[model samples]
Target: MKFGDMELYILSDGTLTEDGGGIFEYYPKNIWASYEVDGMTPYRTDEHNNILAAANCLLIRHPEGNVLVETGVHDKTLNYVKYHNIVKNPSLMESMKSAGFKPSDIDIVINSHLNPDHVGWNTVIEDGRLKPTFENAKYVIQKKEFRKAMDPGFELKNDYFSAEEDVLPLEGSGTLELVEGEKEIFPGISVIPTPGHTSGHQSVMIRAERTMLYAADMAALVMHQEKPRCKMAFDALGREECWRTKKKLLYDRAAENSWYTYFYHETSFSVGIIHKITNTRGEMEGRVEKVEIL
Candidate 1:
């Protein structure tokens, strides 16, 4: 999809089937089951009622530089029980090749956070040693995020399991660039803190003719974008902060500016414009509407 002079490609690592109850946390199964966007459910459940979601990465082709956001889960990470049902189509590498580029073509790799699924492709095992997958690119991430992932407290340690192998290895390779707050890696591409899932979680923004917000896991699916209060069990670290950020970005910023929003785990209609709507109770809500790119 081309927006102005920039071409954006969604490269999916694969699908992850999660326990519906686990991802939705305390949200009642009956209520969440009724949720839909544009007549399509971004998630699906098998007979056992598990939520199957997609792991999508974004590739930006800009004159200034080529940016790859969210590396997607690596095959090695699939050994974990949670990822046992993961399905990879055109893996990140294959998808990048299909996009007319190689790992060397990537200028920067942006990680929204250091979660296992989001940073799995940061490194690849070569000669039985882990190495940065995109050898020529700088793996840009939040300094605070790196610190937390490296030394997480007991309660959140599970979330950083792959950091030791997939994330920390970048440091030794001299390919990691940790920044504070908001920083623009390219002229129009910047990362802003949107902490909820993790204290250091950040999101990508593409400022073109129409701004684009890669909400990442902050709005993992359209359900969260359409209803800002909807949160996942993964956000236990900063649930309230996450809700506020969602309200501010998806509602105040994206909807107000008509920006094209992208949710990482949304299997259907992952990219759209969030329009503000008044529901039956006269409350302001967001509606994820379809978008077209030139």
Candidate 2:
């Protein structure tokens, strides 16, 4: 949707299927079992009856230049079972083109963290060499997250290859900017520290007269924002900090009347707002409304 002079668009590289257990591993089985599913349909499982999971990405644009929040898994690297049916699709680039942009036209690439799903398109593998996919843009990453990913002894699993490929090369080429908390990267766009999921994880906040907080993995799904106490199994800092941040930000956005609140893994609509309402018991509750992706 249009916000001031900036034009925001949601572009899908594609979709990835995950297991509910993997996504929410920290919650007790009984608690997860009792959790209610609302509005959306749960992923159908095999005969075993396990719940499935999926996620998408968001791309935003302003008159100053194009900013891509996350890059979907590129075509050749989708073979890993972690992501079902992952294939190189020009959908992201195509969508950008349809929106009047070429890959080279993107001026900035903001990665929430070094996660594989988020940095997949950081580079395009060609002839055994890794290169920046968006050649002209400056890649923005948190300083601490870069150091963690660069540790030689760190396990390469959980999509860490994204760090070896997409992120490091940019740093080497002098195209990466490492920022600390609340640093402005582009006009009206700032990077805010929201660690917990990863030691250096971050979220993007866009400001005009109103604000748009891109919660990133800070609150992956609507459920996390709605029920901030619910922690994800994949969280690195333990669930306590993650939940605390979620609750605080959910309330902060409402109090400030942020124009939009965006989540990285929300399926229905990638960009939206969370409203706080009081229930019959006079308890505060969060309700999400999907914003039109312009």
What candidate 1 gets wrong by more than 4 Å, as runs, is 81-84, 292-294
The clash numbers for all candidates, in the given order, read 0, 2
What count of clashes does model 1 give?
A: 0
Instruction: Please tell me which predicted candidate would have the highest TM-score against the true structure.
Output: 1
On lDDT, the candidate that comes out on top is: 1
Candidate 1 matches the true fold with a TM-score of: 0.95
lDDT of 2 by residue, 1-294 (tens): 787778777776666655566565655655554454355544344444345433355666777788888876534454663445553344577767776778888889998888777887788877888888888988888888888778624443554655676677777676788887778877899888888888788888888777888877777766666654555666777777775676666665642363578766655566767777766777666666777654
Worst 10 residues of 1 by lDDT: 75-84
Query: Which digits, one per residue and each the tens of the lDDT, describe model 1 over residues 1-294?
Result: 987788899887887777777677777887677677678665556777888788889999889888899998745754673554777786888888887989889889999999888887899889999899999999999999999999998988988888889888898788999999999888888999988888899999889888988988887878777765677887846667887888877778887777889877877766898778878888877788876543
**RMSD of candidate 1 to the true fold?**
1.6
Q: TM per model?
A: 0.95, 0.86
Alpha-carbon RMSD of each model: 1.6, 3.0
